[model samples]
Target: MKKIYLLFISCLAAFILNLILMNSAADMPVFFTSYLNDLLCMPIVLSICLFLIKSFSRKKSIRISLFSAFSLAALYSVYFEIYLPKVNTRYTADFTDVLLYFSGSLIFWLTHKFDSPKNIQKTT
Candidate 1:
């Protein structure tokens, strides 16, 4: 429940921040601002997906989920680097952007790995 709440809040903030960046005088999408958009959205989206995936099977501990989530994020970041630009002209492949994505993932992984329910027994 807490995870879901946090994901919603963060994703909403990211979207709002993206909107804010776009509507500013720059008059361009945030994504066009040198990975500013990726830096904002990657963690929210990836962490949510990773949380969802981890929730599917409760057999794994928080550490495993953390590693898996970050690993998946890294793999997907690499995937985007190799495939996204090819799929669309609006995007160009960039490893540095992927680095930002991985950083976000790692942060979330650590947060959840240490504090997730897997580490606690619900009293209720």
Candidate 2:
């Protein structure tokens, strides 16, 4: 739980920094301005979602499965990259963004953990 909270806060802070950099006039690398947000998106969103689910279900052991992470990545890719681009001129499809989304999902899957009692053992 502490790890998840820390991960979420760190990711959120990165997001805020990215937003500030996006608006700043100082020259920045393409990765910072363009791809950092995409890379951070899923971990932040999924962490929040997981927090809500845990709160409502009151299950400390619950975690997001890999399949669910992949499904979410696919859904986000379809909507943000494929569908939105077709409908809105402001949005353009980027395959790299899709990949970054999946990468973020993987990060969430790997880092989101709950320190449940079941995970601990009595030692002599």
Cα error, candidate 2, residue 110 (Å): 0.6
Q: Which 10-residue window of candidate 2 scores lowest in summed lDDT?
A: 115-124
lDDT of 1 at 10: 78
lDDT of 2 by residue, 1-124 (tens): 3776788899999999889877985788899988999999999988888878768875556778778877889999999999999999999999999999999998887775333435432111
The residue pairs found clashing in candidate 1 are none
Count clashes in each candidate, considering only residues at least 3 apart in sequence or on different chains: 0, 0
Please report the candidate that would top TM-score against the real structure: 2
Over 1-124, each residue of candidate 1 has an lDDT whose tens digit, in order, gives 5554475477668678776776785767445556665665555775566456568857444343455655766777767787878888877788887788777666665555555655642110
Off by over 4 Å in 2: 113-124
Query: Quick one: best lDDT, which candidate?
Result: 2
Clashing pairs in 2: none
